[model samples]
Target chain A: MSGTALTQQRDLFARLVTLGEEVTDALDHTNVVSTLGEEELNRAIAAIGDRALPDAATSALAALAASVERVIAANDPHRAIDWIGMQPRLALTLLAATLNPASLPKDVVPPSSGATVAARIPAGISFSDAPRDGRAVVYSGIQADPILRPLAVAIANATPAERLIARAVMNDPEPTAAEAAALFAALPSHRTTTDPLVVGALAIGGKAQASNAQYRGAVVEATTAEMLRRRPVLANDADRLVRRERRFAIDGVSADPHPFDVTVEAGPVPELWDCKWGARGIDASLLAELEDARIRAAGSSARIAIGVVAFDTAAIVAARLTIVRAPREKTRFITLETLGRLAAG
Target chain B: MARAVSTPPDAAHPARRPARFATRGHDAAAAHLATLLADAPPHALLIVGPRGAGAGTLARDAVATLMCGEPVDGGPCGACRACRLIASGSHTDLVVINPTGESNTIKIDQIRALAAGFALFSVEGGRRIALIEHADLMNEDAQNALLKTLEEPPSRTHVILAAAEDSRLMPTIRSRCAVIRLGLPDAKQASELLGERLGVDAPTAVRLLRMSSGRPGPLIDAEATGDAARAHAQIRRQILDFAATQPHARLGQLGALVADARAILVAGDDDGNAADGTESDDSSDDAPDVDAEPKKKSPAKRSAKPTPAERRAAATALLRLWRGVARDLALVSTGAVDQIAFPEDRAEIEAVAHRLPPATWGEALHAIDKTLSALRRNGNPELLLDAAALSWPTL
Candidate 1:
C-alpha cells in the first residue's frame, strides 16, 4: 500500500474510534442505554464481534462497546412506568416486547407505575387524608398505613438472618420513606460508578442525574412481587398446589418452585401458575420461556398443567409457523376475568 | 401490530354501513341506548371508553338518531336534514363542547353556555342534545356546573357526556348519568368496515384497520385525508433506512421521528400532514402543549411525557408504525410471508430480518412494546430511542 493510502486510512480509522466513543457517551445519558440496556448492549456487541473487522481497529471498537455497556449497566433500572396514572395492558405489553430475555440486574418485576397496595391506616383519617410518600405515617402513635406493614412486620417477625435486610433499610434514611418502604427493606447495595466511558475531550456529558429517586427506583420494585403474592384469586388458586403445611410466598426463595412464578400441586401433576398485573400484556420471550418450563415439567407428571394469569394484560406470543397456528393457542393466555371461572376448575 | 391483516372478504356487503347507531364494535351499548329511547330517554347519558374507542361518535349518533325527523328502523336516517346538520356540526339542537385550556379542562364557562343552549327549545322542534366531548376534561368546578344540569335535564332535552375514561369524571356527574362504554370491533369487523368505507380491497382494509386500531370512523377520515397511509409509509421507510444511516445521523432523526409520531397519532391531520381528524376523541392530536402556558410544564413533561389518557391512545399511535414494522420483521424472520403488515416493504423487511435470527425478532417486537410502554410511562424519548439503537442488530 502507498504511504498516502495508509495516511488516509489512518485518519479514517481515528475518526471511527472517535465516533464509537461519541455514540457511547451519547448513549450513556440517553434512554436507549436505560431501556435496551446492559443485556442488549452486550448481545449486540457480541453479534458484531462475530463479524470480521480490521485487526488494528477491533480492540478499540470492542473497548468502546465494553465501556458503553458498563456505563449503561451500572445505572438503576429506569422506572419505565412512572409517568402514567394507571397501568394500561397495551403499554406494558409493548414495553415488554422491547426487552430481551436476559434478566434485569435486579430481576424482580417492577410495580405498576401508578399502583401500590392501599395501605391500612389509623382510624379517624380518611384514605385521601393519608400521606402519599413511602414513610409509614403515624397519627397519635397509630400505624397510619399498612402498605409497608407486611415487610415491616416480616423483618421484625423473621427468625434471625432476615433481620439484617430490615436493619439496613432502617439505617438508610432514603429508602425508608414512601408507600414502598417494605419494598425498600429488601434491596441490593445502592452504588453508582464515577468512571467515564471515554478519556479527556470524549468523556460522557450530562450523565447520571443522581438523586434519591435513583436508589428508590430499584428498591421499590421489591414490593410489587409481594403485592402479587397476596392477590386474592392468584394466591387462592396457587394454594391448591401445596402438599405440605407450608405456603410459598418469598420473591426468590431457594425453596420456592422454579420455572413458574407461583407453583402448587394437589393432584398427581404439579400445577404452575405465573401471575402478572402489568396493564400491558407480556412479551413473547417471557411467555415462551414459561411455556418451555411447562414442557420441561411435563416429563415429571402425567398431565402437566401450567397457566399464566394476568390482570389487565395480554401476551403477544410468537409462533413456529405451521405447528403453531395461533400464538394464543400454544400458551393459554388467561386474564383476571377468566380467573373467576378457574376458581372452581 | 399495525400491519395488513388477513381477513376473509365479505364481498356481498362490500360497503356495509354498519354504523347504524353511530358505533361499530359497540352493538350492545347501542342496543341499550336504543332501549332507553323505547320509553323515555335518560336525562343524562355518560358514554365512556378508552380514547378513540368511539364514545364521541356514539354520543353524536345518539343525538342524530333522537333528532332525525325520519327515523329509520332503529336510529337516525342519515339522509334527513337533521342528520346532515349534525354531521356538519352546525345543528342548533346539537351542542358540542370540548376542553379549552392547556390543562385540557372544560371550564365552567363552557358549561354555562351549554346550560343556556339546553334551556331553550330546539330550533327544529326536536330534543335538545348537548354533546359534551371529553366530559372528564371538566375539572371539579366544571363538573359541578354540569352536575346540576345532569340532575334533571329539561323533560325534552338530553345531555350526552362523552369521556375517554370514566374515572376522570366527577362522581356526581357519573352517578347522575346512565353510562355506555364502547370498545373496539374485532380486527375482522374493523377490516370489513374499513374496506367498505375506504373503497379498498379487504386486504388493504385489514392493513389500514390494524393501523387505525380498527375504528372505521378514523380509518375513513385517514383514508380520505391520506394521513394514515402517509405517516405510516414515511415512518416505515425511515425505520428501514435507519440501518444504512450513520449512527450520528440517526440520533438527530429520532427527534423528528418522535415529533412526527406524536402528530400522526395525536393530531392525525391537523398538522397539515393528516387528511382529517378523528372525532372529538382526536387523540391523533399529539400536538405539543403549545397552547398551554409553557412555563407551567416541567422540563421533563415538556420533552417525553404524555397524559395518562394519551399513553394508551395517541402517544402509542406512533408506535403502531413501529409495531407493524416489528411485526412484519418477526414474520419475515419466522418465514411467515403471508402475515406481513407491509407487503410493499417485503424485500427490505426480509433483508433486515436476515440480519437477526428469527428469535431476535420476538425480542425486537417486545423491545418496541417496551419502548411504547416507556414512552407512555414518560421515559425520555431520546433515552428510549437510544436504547433501541444500541440493541438493534448491526450490519
Candidate 2:
C-alpha cells in the first residue's frame, strides 16, 4: 500500500477503535450517552465495508450496527442492557479484523469445523508438560499468512522466557524436566515475561488470560510468587507448601469448590491467598469471595486463614474497609512485603 | 440596646447566622426550594450537579430551612437555637452522611444505620433531616438500602441527597426523589461570586471561574483552586511543548510527562481533600492498618509514591487534560477561539493549532478519549499512554 493509503487505513482503524470505546462506555453505564445516535454506528459500518474483512466479520459488524440502531429507534429503557449483550462479540470481531485483516479467510469457515479443530487441541499444557524445544507450534500454521509473518519473526527473536510462555500458551507438549525446572526458576527474575508477543500469544490461546482483567490477575500472581521467593525466611519454611490453582470446598463459599491462586499449607492452619491486581480488582466480588472463604474456614473450626495479596495500597485499604462489617480476625489484608513478614513469623 | 455584631457571609462558614442561601445564579433553584419549604417538602429530594456546582451547599441550605426554629424569608433564621445547633453540627434531628474511608464510598452498613436512625422520633418534635453528600458514590447495596427510605420516608422526616453525578444512582432510588438539576452557573454571576468569596481581583476571579467551568463551590478554597489552576496551566504548557517537539522527541518525553502528571494529581488530591474536609473518613479506625510503619514526612512527600489507583487516576486526569487541549486546538483551528476552555493560553494554543489540521485535533481528542475509557477499565497505563502518545499530533 502507498503511504497515503496506509495512513487512511490507520485513521479508519482509529475511528473504529473510538467507536468501539464509545459503545463499550455506553454499555457500561446507562446515562453515559444522553442520546444514542446511529451516526457513528453507520460510519463504522461503512468503514468496515471499506476494509478487506472476511464476510463473517463484515456481517457481524453490520448486525451489531443494525441492533444498535434498532435499540436507539426503540428508545428502550433497557438499551444499555441490549448494548452490553452485543458489545463483547462486536469488540472481539473488530479486534480480530483489525489485528490481522490479511489472515482472515476469504471464504467463511464452518463453525463446527473450527470447534472440531479447537477440541482436537489439548485443553491446556501445564508448566511441566511444555515442550523442551520452546517453539510455538501454533504459529507454524499461521506463519504462511503475510500479516502474521512479521509477528512470528518477532516471536522467533523473543527471549527464552517469552518463548517458554508462548510455547506453554500454545498447548505444546511438555518440556524436558530440566528445561521446565530452569524456566520455572527463571520466571521470578525474568523482567521481560510480559512482552507484547508473549501477551498476544496468551490472549490468543490461554482462556484464562483472554481478557485484560484475567491477564492482570496472571501478572499479579507471578509478581506475588516472585516476592514470596525473594524473602529467605518465607522461602525456607520447611513446613510450608505453596501451590497454585488449588480448589477447596469451603462449605457455603460457593455451590462449587472455590479456586485460589496461591494456597499455603503451613502448620495446622492453611492460608488461602487471592491476588487482586489493582484497585478496581478489589471490589464487591473480592469481598464476597473473602467473606465466603472466611465463613467456610470458620465452619471448619477456623482451620484456614483467608488472605488477600493486593499490590495497590489503596486497594488493600479499600478492601479492608469493605469487609470491616464481618468478623475479620482470621482474614488479613497483605501486600507482598507484609505477606513475607507474616510468613516469616 | 447595643446592636449585635454580624459577621460577613463566608463560603467556609456557610452556616453562619442569618443563613441567606446566598449562592449566585441559583435564584430559580432557591425559589423552588423556598416554595417546597413554604408548604410540604418532598419526602426525598435529589440535588444533582457536576463537581463543584454547589449541590452540597444547596442541600445544606434546604436542610437548615427545614430544621430552622425560626424562618426568615423561607430560609433559616440562623440566630435560633435550632440554627445554632445545626451550624455547630450538633443538631439531634439533622444527620449528615459522607463517603467514608479510602474507599470513598457510602456502604450499605452506613445506609442501614441511617435507616435505623429514621425509626426514631425527631428530638425537636420537628422535621428530621438526613443529608447524604456525594450520594453518587454510594455502592449498589448502599443505593439499594437507601431505596427503601426514599420510597417511604418517615413522617416529618426529609432525606436530601446531593450527588455530583446523579446518573450513578440507581434508577429506583432516583425515581423516588424529587430531582433538582443544577446546571453551570451564569458565568458573570459566578465570576462575581468567586471574586467576593476568594477575595481575588476581577480578572483573577474570572480566570479561576473559567478554570472551574463556572462553578462557585470549587472557589471556596482559594488556595487549592489556585493550585489546581496552576497545575492546569502547567499541563497546558506541557502539551504545547510536547506538540512542538518532533514525534521521536515526544515519545522520549512521555515518561517525564507521566511523572509530572502524577505529581500534579498527588498535589491536587492533598490540597483538595484538606480544603474540602469532607474526606475525614480517611482517618477513621476502619482504615487498613496493614502498613503500620509510620512515615513522619509531610503528606506530599509521603504520597509522592502513589498507589496503582492513584497512578491510574493521574493518567486519566492527564488524558482528560490532553483531551481538553485537543478540543481547544480544534476550536482555535476552526476560528472558534472564543469557545476554547483555556482562554488565557489562547496564543500558545493557536500557535499549535496553526501547525496541525482540524482533523488531527479531532483524532487526538478521540485517541485521548479512547485511552481514558481503557484506563478506567484498568488497561496498562504505560501501554495506553504510549498508544495515545503515538496518536498525538506533533508540531
Candidate 3:
C-alpha cells in the first residue's frame, strides 16, 4: 500500500480504538471479558481502524467490554452482542464510507477539468482490499464529511427508510442517475437533494429541475385526457375532445397551431398528422379528428391528405395514411397499412 | 280359493251384475274372501275404485249373483225379480253409500246409518247387501267404531269389498275383510266398453276410452253426462295451468282421489253404499274394528288423509298435459304443424318453448313427477313447484 493509504489506515485505527473504549466503559465488566473476549475485541478494534470517535468513545468502549464479559459469564452471550449492537452511531461511522463506495470522492477528474482527488487513488484498490482499514475510514470519513453525517445520524437513529437505503448501499453498487431519479420519485420527501454531493452532481447534469418539470407536464397531460374521456360530448375520444391548440387571448385572437413536430408541403393539399412514440400507433380517436380536419380543409385549393407518424427516441417517420370513412358518421378509421408504413419509416 | 258365496234370497239381485275390475277378477275376489273374510263374515258388501274402474258394477255383479235365489255359474241370473230391482237401482236390500253434495268422502254419519241397516235382520231371511263407493276416507274414529261389527260379523252375510289400491285403508281394517284391487282396463276393453255399452261413436269411444285412463265408469259417466271431452279438456287445461303454478296441488288432487278409491276398497264388504245407496253411515261400524286391534294401530298414520295421493295424481295429470305440450312443440319445431305452440298462451309459450330442446318437455314431465313425490313427502311445495317449472332443459 502507498504511504498515504497507510497513514489513512492508521488514522482510522486510532479513531476505532477511541470508539471501542467508549462502548466498553458504557457496559459492565464481566461481558467485556467473557463474550467479547480480548481476541474479539482486538478483532473489532482492528476492523474499525482509524474511524471517527465521539467525546466519551474510549471510556465507553472499555466499560462496554467489561459489561459484555459479565453477561457472557452469566450465560447470556446474546445480551453482550445486543448491548454493543445498540451503539448504532459508532457502527454507522464504522460502515458508511466502506459500504457505500459512491460516497467516496470521485478519483477520476472530469475531462477538461482540473485533476480530481479520486484520480490520486490508484486504480482498483477495491473497497474490500482492507476490510479492517476500510471500516475505520468509513467511520472517520462519516464524522469528517458534512454531507454524509446526517445519513449516518439517520442510520444511527434507525429510521426505516434510511436503514433500507443503508442496507441497499451496503449490499449493492452506487445507483446511476436514472436509478437515483426513481428513488427520489418514490421517496415521500418534497425537498430537493439535501446532500451537497448529490446537489452538485444534479446541477452539473441539469437534471434535478428537468425531472420534476417532466413529471408535472405528464400529470397535466394525463389529467386532460382523463377529463376529455369522461365527457359525454366527446364520444369517448380523448384526442378529438381535447384541443389544447385552441388557447384564446382576451382580444379573441388565437395563435395558429403549428403541427406538433411535423413539416408540411404546400402542394395544394391540407395535411393532417398524428404522432405517437415507439411505433405504438396512434389512438383511434386521433384518426377521427383528422377526418374532421379533412372536411374543414375542403372547398379550398388545398387537397387534404391525412398523415400518420411513428416515433422512436431518435426521430419520427411519416407515411401516407388511408382513412376508412364511417358508414353512418363522417368520421373515419385509419387503416393498418398506414400504421405499418409509419413504423417502416 | 273360496267359492263365490251366493247371495241370500232376501237381497235383491240387480238385473245387470256389476262390472269387473281388471285387477280384481271374479277369482281374486273369491280367493280374497277365502283368505280374509272366512274368519269373520260380513252382511254387506262395499265396492271402491277409480270412478270408471267399475266398483259399482262389480258390486252389483257380486250382489246379484249372491241374491239371485239361484246363480248361474258365478254370475247373477238377470231375469230374476231381485236382479230386476237391483239393476233398476230400486232394490231395498241392495244399498249403496255415495257421497253427499259432490263430497269426496263418505261421512261418519253415512257409515253409521249404513250400520243400522246391517244391524237389522234381513226382511227376506237372507244377506242384506251394502256397498260403499269410497271406503278409505273413514277417519280413525269412524274406523274404530266399526271394529266390533267387523270382528263378529252377522250370519248369512257375504261381503265383497273392492278398491283400486289396498294401501289407502288401515292395515287393521284391511286385515278384517277380503280385498279386491281394480286396475285400469286394457285399451281394447275400454274401447269396447265405451262403444258397445255406452253407444259412443268409434272416434269418441277411442278418445274417451284412452283418456279415461282405463276406467269404464269415467267413460260411462263422461258419455252419459255428455261431458267426457269437455271434462277431459278442462282437466288438461287445469293441469297445464296448475303445473306451472302449483305442483303439489295436482299431486294432492291425484292422491286424494286415489285415497278415496283405497278407502272405498275396505268398505265394500261392510256397507251397500258401494253400489247405489248414495249416502250411508257404515264407517262407524268399522271404526271399532280398527281401535280394537291395538297392535295394528299405526302411530305414524294420522287420520287417513288422501290429500297427498290426490295431489300426486293431479301432478301425474299435469305430466300428461306436458306430454301433450311436448308433442305439440315437437310438431311445430319439426314443421309438422302450423298451429300455435301453446294455444292458451301461444305467444309466450311458443317463444320460450321453441328455444328449448324437445327433450326438455320430457324433462319437465319427469320433474313434475319428482315434485309430486317431493310434495307427498311434505317437502316445500313452492320449491318443488319452482324447480319443476324451471326443470325444462335449455335448447
Separately for all candidates shown, the number of backbone clashes (residues 3 or more apart, or on different chains) is 40, 7, 135
Per-residue lDDT tens digits for candidate 1, residues B53-111, read: 56776677778778888877557889889988977878888777777765767899999
Give all TM-scores, in the order shown: 0.44, 0.52, 0.34
- Summarize candidate 2's per-residue lDDT along B1-395 as a digit string, tens digits: 12112222245333222337755566667666666666667788888765555667778888888888888987888889888998888998888888777687889999999899999988888888898887888899999899888777788888988876667888777777777777766778777876676577777766666554465554453232455556667877888777765433454466567676654443233212211111211221111110111112223553655665556555665776677787788879888988877777889988889876676677667666656655544454554564465336555
Question: What TM-score does chain A of each model score against the native chain A?
Answer: 0.28, 0.36, 0.21
Give every collision pair in model 2. A129-A174, A130-A173, A130-A174, A130-A175, A131-A173, A131-A175, A132-A175
Scored against the native two-chain complex, candidate 3 gets a DockQ of 0.01
lDDT of 2 by residue, A1-345 (tens): 122232343343333334435544333332222111132333334334445644443443343334344334444333233233223323332433344332111111111211111111112211111232323244222322332333334333343233333433332111223222222223332323354554444443333212333443554454444444433333554224555555555432331144676666443455567776433244456656766765655665655566666543221233233323333323455431123333232
Q: What interface Cα RMSD is found for model 2?
A: 16.1
**CA lDDT scores, all candidates in order:** 0.46, 0.52, 0.37
Q: Give the distance in Å from residue A55's predicted Cα in candidate 2 to where it truly belongs.
A: 33
True contacts kept of each: 0.00, 0.00, 0.00
Name model 3 segments beyond 4 Å from true: A1-345, B1-51, B100-103, B224-319, B323-362, B370-394
Candidate 1 is scored at a TM of: 0.44
Worst 10 residues of 1 chain B by lDDT: B288-297
Q: Sort by TM-score, best first: what order?
A: 2, 1, 3
Candidate closest to the true structure, highest lDDT:
2
Which candidate number has the best TM-score? 2
